[model samples]
Target: MRKLIIGITGASGACYGIRALQMLREIEDVQTHLVISPSGMRTALEEGTGLSGEDIRALADVCHHHKDIGASIASGSFRADGMLVAPCSIKTLSGIAHCYADDLMTRAADVCLKERRRVVLMVRETPLHAGHITLMDQATRSGAIIMPPVPGFYTQPKTIEDLVTQTVGRALDLFDIDHPSVRRWKKECATEA
Candidate 1:
């Protein structure tokens, strides 16, 4: 089984985390370990993730507390296939960049790096500065994929749900997990022609 860790940080776009979890739930081969940062919890409440922590826990095959640094997911020996921090905030990004394992989320990210597992950071921020770029560069150097949640115009999405699905689908693709939300680009059908 592919053991995956999905961390929800306190980024403005809480929907991405929720959507990612929803997608992960469909993969039979994937066993997920979920951890939500304190700030993410507040964001989840503010934005209303539409599901409670318990609800999320049930969606995931395995869940871990964010503050539980002693959790098995926090150890490199646990052998996670990858870790994804969707809606990763600037603070959390910097924390991971500096190897600040103050919490289980960061610790698990650190473990992902040390263990050479794929770590995808879905950062949701704009108006970047030098510090943000530097932190991102540092994390990438340490073997983390920084995927900013910048929506594209090519798809010409008609609804917020479309945009969310595309982003979440892309994240899942990184881990080779199949999600139906994403519309894989294909040539126009004869009906459209």
Candidate 2:
């Protein structure tokens, strides 16, 4: 089984994380372990996922408390394929870059880095400053992929859902997890019959 660790932080784009979990649940062989920060839960409510944090937790195969630094995922021996922090907050990004494992999400990411496993952070910040740039640089040096969810309009998305799913799909692609929602760029658009 492929083990995937998903972290959700307090960011505006909670929908990305929610949609990712919904897609992951459809795959039979993937075992998803989830950890959500308290602020993340609040953002889910504020952003109106229409699903409570508990409801979201139900989507995962296993859910860990944000404060549980002793969780299995915090250790390098947990044997996960990779970690993804979708809609990652800048605060969480800074913490992960600095190896500040004050919470399970950061701790798990740190472990992934130490284990040489892929750690993709879908950072959800805009109008970034020099400090954010430095943190991203530091994180990249530490083996983290900083993926901001920038939309590709070339996909000809007609709805906001299209954009969100496309971003989430691309994030899953980083881990090589196949999602049906992605609309890959083609050399030419298919013509009507």
Candidate 3:
């Protein structure tokens, strides 16, 4: 069974995390472990996700509290294939970059880096300044992938849902998890040619 640790920070794009969780549920033999920051829950509700915080938690096979620093995922010994910080807030990125285990989300991310596991951060910020760029550099040097969920216009998405699905699918691709909904550019180009 492939074990994946998912962290949802207090960023604006809660949909990325929620969509990832929803898609992962359909994949057999893949177990999803989730952790949501306090602000993340608030954002989910405030953004009108149509699901209560508890309902969102139910999508995962296991859920860890953001305050639970002693959770299994916080330890390096707990083996996981990878970790994804979807909608990674700049605050969380700073914490992970500095190796500060102040919260469970950062702690688990730290553990993943130390364990030589893949860590993908779907950072949700724009108009980047020097500080954000520096932290991203630091995180990348520590073996984390800074993946901002930018939409692909070539897919010619007609709805917001299509863009969200494509972004989430690409994030999952980093873990080599195949999401059927992803519209591959190569395939589309090939068909066009």
Maximum-lDDT candidate:
3
Q: Which residue pairs overlap in candidate 2's backbone?
A: none
Cα displacement (Å) at residue 104, model 2: 0.2
lDDT of 1 by residue, 20-56 (tens): 8888778777888889887887888789667776775
- The TM-score obtained by model 2 is 0.95
The Cα error of candidate 1 at residue 185, in Å, is: 2.0
- Screening candidate 1 with a backbone cut-off below 3 angstroms (N, C-alpha, C), the clashing residue pairs are none
Please give the distance, in angstroms, between residue 54's alpha carbon in candidate 3 and its true position after superposition: 1.3
Give the least accurate 10-residue stretch of model 2, judged by summed lDDT.
181-190
- TM per candidate comes to 0.91, 0.95, 0.95
Model 2 has a clash total of 0
Which regions of candidate 3 are displaced past 4 Å? 187-193
The candidates, ranked best first by lDDT, are 3, 2, 1
* Candidate 3 Cα deviation (angstroms), residue 137: 0.5
Tell me model 2's lDDT, rounded to 2 decimals.
0.92
